[model samples]
Each structure stands twice: as structure tokens, then as C-alpha cells.
Target: MIKLTERQDKILQIVKQNGPITGQEIAVKLSLTRAALRPDLAILTMSGKLDARPRVGYFFNENYEVKRQAEKFLHQQVIDYKAHPIVVDKSTAVYDAIVQLFLEDVGTLYAVDSRGHLAGVVSRKDLLRATLGNKNLHELPVSVIMTRMPNIFTIRPDATLLEAAKKMIDNHIDSLPVVKEVEEQRNTYFLLGRITKTTITRAYLEIMER
Candidate 1:
């Protein structure tokens, strides 16, 4: 939905409070001529924010608010709010990985090989399962439990926040690794950042408040 101008908002308020009001009456309230208010009325009506009748005037469209919110989410780009990735080497010990997870206070960590390409993803649950009844956390490599490339879900930097949120819901995961495709490699990607449910929630709050 298109954003309303201050005048348009005032007009909406007037029509809402005094529903089925005529164009002439609305113009008078705004201290403007009917001709001057014509364009705004047409836009609001065309955009489904207002409905008009031959003899009756204008009334608020009940569905406009929902449409406006959906449009807002659809336009929000992920790169604007994506956070830095917390990473660990694939060969890092499970014990050291657990320490890093708590130290960083994050739910997930991206594991990379020696060349720094995204190799796998390790979640808190993965680490927990790995450490149960195991005393050799120091010797056990994180690679043992990490979700490898073919199974790891990821998003691109330019994807919309709505897309990011949908991926999390569809995959039943808490976070996604943001990556850029390598020019020379066929299917390899370079990890750029991370987007999570928390990031989307914060973005929604910021947008709504603004």
C-alpha cells in the first residue's frame, strides 16, 4: 500500500469519524475546495483505502491496514539488518565450540574449513547432543555434528527480510547464513553474514515504531 501524506491522513480521519461523508464536506473540513481534494480521494479510493458510492460519500476500506503492513514487510531488505556471523573452524573441538557458543551468546555458529568457505552449520542442540556422556570433548571435532552444505539452508545478501523469515519458518530453523556465490567455484558460496528470527523481530519493531 502507498504511504499516505499528512493531508491524506487527515482526510481519512475525517471520513472515518464522519463515515459516508461527501467529498464537499471533507474538503470543507480541510479548508480546501472539493477540486483540490479530488486527487487524494481518487487515490485513496483506487488504492482500496476508501470506497465511494453514487449518492453516499466515502468510507474506510477494512482491508487496507493489512495490505499496508504486508507491503511494508515485502519491501524491507535483509542486508540492512543482517548481523555479523559467529564462526568456528570445522576441526575445532566440541568443547571449545560450546565455550564459543556461550561466549558469543548465539544460538548457532557457522563452521568453515581451512580456506574459509562455509563448510557447515552447528546449533546449540548439536553441541549438546555431541557432549552427552562424552568426556573427550577436546578431541571430538565439531564437524562430527555440524550440518553440511547440501543440508544447510542459506540466503543471499539481497533477499528481502520477509523471504528470510519464510525460510526460517519453512525449515524449522532459528537462523540462516547469508552468502554470496563464488565467481570461480561452481556451487561454493562465500559466507557474508547471518540473519535470524531475532533480527527480523527487531526489524519489525523498528519499522512499526517508525
Candidate 2:
């Protein structure tokens, strides 16, 4: 993340609030030279915090705008961008899980119980650590090394993208499980999708341009 100076932050605020505006106007109001302002603008755009359009000027990326609007816009809902989650039964062998991870090229895998409810998460690191000295990969069950339920981070379908981003940052986790509430079953949950840090960054850029 690019660190912004006080002046830079003020400049961004001005542009976000009243942009598609000219640099001269911004300079005059902020009491800065056009040459001085140039570097700030370049940095903002480079950091994915601002976008400059030719004739349209610059505008605040909608993703960074936290205020709620009624318009049908992007928001964090797992089904919207989650890829088909690769899952393995708790009974799956460690060797098989490693094979799946390589084939899928994902950092983590979801472990589901017999009922299809989320049981645990097995990251690639976990599998590697578990297989370090063991020769019985085929006999070991994934359940032995998985991050169990109640410890897993999850998000609902209606949450905003900002909320999801904050959660991921706070946990220092790369991905999240998107689970849906069953209509008739109160205690059970079904994994609908998954979200990643890359997903959030891409969506943030897309919304900001609007």
C-alpha cells in the first residue's frame, strides 16, 4: 500500500469530491504548484487509489465510496465472484489432497463433512507441514490437520465489499468461505463460494473507475 502524506490525502479528498476537475483548479484551491501536484496525482493513480480519465477528468472510485446507494452496484456477495470451491471429504488422504492442490493451483481447500456443511479448511502450507516426516500419507486423514469449524472466517451474501476486505486484513488470511443459510435447516450451512484478496483488489479497481 502506498503511504499518503497529509497534502496528498487532502488532494485525493478534493478530487474525489469534485473531480473530473482540472489540475489548475485543484492547485489554485490547495495553494500548490502544478508541478508539485503532478507527483501526487501520479502516485494516487499508481496505487489504485485514483483513476484519471481524458476528458471526464478524475472521480472517486465507487468501491472506495462507503456511502450506501440504491443503485444496483457491486457489493460483497460470495456467489458473485467465487470460483467453484474445490472440496475434499474429511476422510480424504493427505497425499490425495496435495495432488488436488497442485492440480487446482489454489492456496487452500475446503473440507466438508458428510452432510455438506463446512468442517474445516486445509491450506497448502498445512499439507506440506504435515507430510514433512511422515511416510504414511495414504493412511493419514485430512481431518487430523485441518483448521476446524468455529475457527474459520466466513461472510454472508449481503455484506459490502469493504466489510469483507477489512475481515481479510484483520485475519491475515488470503481467502474466505462464503456460506449460505439454509431455509429449513437452522444449524447447517452450505458453502456457496469463496473470496480471495485478489478478488477484492480487482473488484475495488472496477468500482472505482465507475
lDDT of 2: 0.81
Model 1 per-residue lDDT tens digits across residues 105-145: 99999999898999999999998888785669999898988
Residue ranges of candidate 2 with Cα displaced over 4 Å: 1-76, 182-187, 208-210
Each model's number of backbone clashes?
0, 1
Query: Candidate 2 on 86-191: residue-level lDDT in tens?
Result: 8999899999999999999998899999988988999988898999966699989999999988788888766766677789999999988888866797545788
Give Cα distance to truth, residue 42, candidate 2, Å.
40
Pairs in clash, predicted candidate 1: none
Superpose all Cα atoms of candidate 1 onto the true structure and report the RMSD in Å to 1 decimal. 4.0
Global lDDT scores for all candidate models: 0.90, 0.81
* Best-fitting candidate, scored by TM-score: 1
In model 1, the Cα lDDT at residue 113 comes to 86
Off by over 4 Å in 1: 1-10, 28-32, 73-83, 129-136, 158-172, 196-210
TM-score of each: 0.71, 0.62
lDDT of 2 at 2: 66
